[model samples]
Target: MFVLAAALAATLAACGGGGGGGGQGGEDVTVASDIAYPPFEFERDGEPVGFDIDLLNEVGKRAGFTPEYQNVTFDGIINGLRNNQYDVAISSMTITPDREKRIDFSEPYFNADQSLLAPGDAGIESVDDLGDATVGVQLGTTGEITAREFKDEGTINGEIRTFDTIEDAFNALENGQIDAIINDLAVSQYEAKNSDGNAEIIEVIPTDEQYGIALPKDSDLRQDINEALAEIKEDGTYEEIYKKWIGRAPEEIPR
Candidate 1:
């Protein structure tokens, strides 16, 4: 069954999402993602559930692969794929030139930008005023890249502590371990609300980035995912999954 699934996925890859491949294999696809990124990807009811998960499940159903999730740090997801720790990565990953060198990316399933979050009363708002304060970020994310940018420019002088996950970064901020955290805007909002208003959005960094599924560079999975994604979005499945995790439709969010 597993072999059949691989062949199916491989065939589905080359032919576009026209129809089934040669076999109906049940080969499980190991999808590495950070379970702490709520709304995008996270744990709910002891199972992986989020917009990314749902979107990719639709992809799996259409493209013919059984997705089995593996929880890894957001930063390590790509490496996990390269190391064969997983077959695919659907972690709200952005397609960047730097990243493209390491792995291939599917057509953007979503678009988002890095956003800054902080304690409401801290008088620390925006990336500019973050000078000399501990900046928290989710390792392996565009958010981390944004934080590093601030540090490099001396806009933020304090330590840039990269947490294993966004939940931990937010926890650090809540516990006063860090002044603020950088994350995707919506997921950050979800975390803040789930924390009972302890965290607040400071600013959404103006990063024009599109989210894509990460696969090994030159891997056929990238093309297969993009083809499957196009159909899923067109079929209203994308809208359904978006509403399920994000609570509404996605608008044209200007970066």
Candidate 2:
């Protein structure tokens, strides 16, 4: 009887039983992110570090799971989640109606907008000045969507160059390969500050977008993560993380 009971216990453990939750049940959860986007998710010394990293780590602590981050491109995260290739994604992904149809999202965590970045001497003060210029954007990002909208409205007559990552777009802009770049405002500000005056934010385009923690559709972890996120915001931890990576206390916490 003792031998039979021990074998049964081992089998249950191997089958991921004995935990009182759905899915990972306090185990390591696979987290997908685009690690090149700074002030959000980026690598330092071969480890992920940024606002999204810090925030998600805290959420994991309260949600009774540990996140194992998987570095991937921004455009692939959604499909990866849809395919169950990743458990969660928090790469500064803005919550959108289209994406909500394909995946679930935690409560709003960060507010964002788009910005026009150009060389300081490029004379590109706004989107209106982008006529006949090469405008760079990260593929599958809200920035790219906004730029396309501008083109559709005849706001600019330019080549909308798409890059796999925002860093690549920034590099292209710095090297004079693209006349301007349209990307997230906070990220653009960080780049402009670190660019030694090479690039500057020419215009702040308000998109009224809010970022959220993304998960596979109907994920059981959603409630746990949302509860943890709410607690973090209520207890002032969110502001600390925000100020640490974003360089200022957020004027308002996203809902």
Candidate 3:
């Protein structure tokens, strides 16, 4: 079990941005998240709910703070973090070099990869079926990375349809506008489970990228967040949350 070693005072300080109006007794904090991504963060019955939402709520409880959620877009999470639009971003944001340059990341809270999904009747069983076929992806995402790789290898033909969001990408797939859509496995699983058996996760892509909480760079918050993240994993909170959402906990560090 990994233990969070930072001072408690420090962990609370990282959430020190945005309006401070949740009564004078508790420090006020606001979290920015792309609510469109389900099983991570999304709206359910007019309110945001998901694993990330629960995890952060627990973290706030343990750390002594109150959090306000702002439903922002995925493309805007990083910018919002940097611009001080929110205290932190919990949009299932993957830590990457391009993002690292602009903001800091909490220790990885979840490890997952993009998955490819196709229609059952499309005869698209594997990556081979995607060869010379028009693939779909969400703009500016790991799905786009997988699509480009397929295109470069000449396995994917036709134009790649880029949607502004994953929901749009899946909508395109269901309408037969594209052969398949690639996205995070957790998100893929959520779609499949909720699709009334209309969609399925055809293949799990092999990748090692992970999701982390995003914060502004050069802020003392980074150290504290990493500590809190480590604590969550060290305790049973991380695995507990995983099981509640996806049925099983993933191998923490990724193979």
Candidate 1, after superposition: displacement of residue 57 in Å? 0.8
Candidates sorted on TM-score, descending? 2, 1, 3
List runs of model 2 lying over 4 Å from the truth: 1-25
Per-model tally of clashing residue pairs = 6, 0, 1
Candidate 3 collision pairs:
2-234
Residue ranges of candidate 1 with Cα displaced over 4 Å: 1-25, 253-255
Hey, what RMSD does candidate 2 come out at? Answer: 5.8
Cα deviation of 195 in candidate 1 (Å)? 2.6
Those runs of model 3 whose alpha carbons end farther than 4 Å from true positions after fitting are 1-25, 253-255
lDDT of 3 by residue, 2-111 (tens): 33556655667766544454542456577887788888888889878888998877776656657688886677777787888888888887888888999988777888
User: What lDDT would each prediction earn against the true structure?
Assistant: 0.80, 0.92, 0.77
| Predicted structure 2, TM vs. truth | 0.90
Structural similarity to truth (TM-score) of each candidate: 0.85, 0.90, 0.84
lDDT string for model 2 (92-136, tens) is 899999999999999999999999999989888888988999999
Could you give candidate 1's per-residue lDDT for residues 1-255 as a string of tens digits?
A: 999999999987866433333243455677788877888887778988888888888788778787877788777777777787778998888899998888788888787877889988899768888878888887777888888887787788888898887788888888998998888888888877777777888898878789888888777677777788988888778878877888888784212
Model 1 TM-score is 0.85
